[model samples]
Target: MTTLHTPRLTLRPITPDDLPRVLTYRNDPEVARYQAWALPATLDSVAGLVSDQPLGAPGWVQRAVTLRDGTVLGDVALNTQGPQAEVGVTLARSAQGHGYAHEALHALITHAFTDLGLHRVHASIDPRNTPVAVLLTRLGFRHEGTSLQSYRHRSEWTDDALYAVLAAEWTA
Candidate 1:
């Protein structure tokens, strides 16, 4: 399992004990609003998802983002596609606006590109999520384009903006 340490957070493989906190953040309408799917997440569903993660897949990694104090605050993942990977993140409401997402994501991206030998890492965000767009841009992700109605959330189609950063663009 891959583990990444940031100044205020640790990103490590998801475990059974993290189910409750994961559901707490995922079930929130505010947080689910921007996600690709908006299912009412249950413990069983979370367990299934975590169990299904492709642990041995080359260049694929998923980690639970926790505080140094051991509070599971969210999740960060790198889904591989040839030389590129898709980056995904979800943070608890309480952890928002404190730079934890950026910090954790930065660390994850570094590991993906540098250690995992990926050439590019990308993220897709709901166009309405201005904060994430700004964050990605600040992290050197260039706006790649948009996918119309690419995400199905709550039985509705939503547009997603694709942003990406090349390995050469990463600084930290």
Candidate 2:
């Protein structure tokens, strides 16, 4: 498993023990509502998702965000394609707005671009998710464009904003 440490957080692989905490954020109505998959998250479902994939695959990295105190905050991952990787993050509702996501994302990006030798990382966010969009911008991600009706949310189609940051563009 791959593990990374930041000033205030640690990013590590998701384990079976993390299912309960993962479900906390996954089950949140607000969180799930904006996500492409809106079905209620169950332990079995989460297990299935993680079990089907390997951590730190050749082109991908999936990790659980945790605090120095050992609190599991959420998840952060990089799904890779060639030299670019797609970033995804989910923070526990209670941990939101505390900069934990930012800390974890920075660490993950550094690992992907520096340690893993990746060239670029990007994220697809629902336009309605203003906080995430703002967060990505703060992290040096440029808004590339929007995809119309690109994702299915609660049985309806929704638009997504594409945001990207290049290795040379990252200041952190």
Candidate 3:
């Protein structure tokens, strides 16, 4: 398991104990608005979801983002493919706008490129998510393009915005 640290947060492997916090946010309508998980995430389901992914493997791994004092603020998901990774982040409602997401993601991206030897790190976000778009742009990810009505989300057609940062282009 890889543990990443930022000045204000730590990104560590998600554990069974963190499932309650994970369930809370996963069920929050606002938090799930842009996410694809089924609503009302149960404890058993959350555990199953976490247990299903293999950490440090060629697949999705979830990391719990915490404050230095160990307060759970959110989680980051990384789906590793041979020389690339797709990343996603979710924060507790109270944690939004505090820049913790940026700090945690920066650490994850840094590790992905520098330690994991990935050639590219990218994120696919809903087109309606302007905040995340801004966040990715601020972190040096280029707006490659948007897939029109790429998938049906919550009974509506949703566009996906693709943002990417190349290893050579990354600062850390």
lDDT of every predicted structure (CA atoms): 0.82, 0.81, 0.87
TM-score of 1: 0.90
Q: What is the per-residue lDDT of model 1 for residues 17-104, given as tens digits with 9 covering 90 to 100?
A: 8888898899998887787644788887677446445432555466889999999988887888888889888888888999988998
Checking candidate 1 for backbone clashes, the offending pairs are none
Identify the candidate with maximal lDDT: 3
Q: What is the lDDT for 93 in model 2? A: 86
- Ranked candidates, highest lDDT first: 3, 1, 2
What clash count does candidate 1 reach?
Answer: 0
Model 3 stretches astray by more than 4 angstroms: 49-56
Clashing pairs in 3: none
Segments in model 2 whose C-alpha atoms lie over 4 Å from true places? 49-60
Clashing pairs in 2: none
Ten-residue region with minimum lDDT total, candidate 1: 48-57
The residue ranges of model 1 lying beyond 4 angstroms of the native Cα positions read 49-60
Candidate of highest TM-score: 3
Task: Sort the candidates on TM-score, descending order.
Answer: 3, 2, 1
Tens-digit lDDT track for model 2 on 112-167?
78876778889998998999999999999999999999867777789989999998
Query: Candidate 2 deviates by what RMSD?
Result: 2.2
lDDT per residue for candidate 3 within 81-114, as digits (tens), equals 8999999999999999999889988988888887
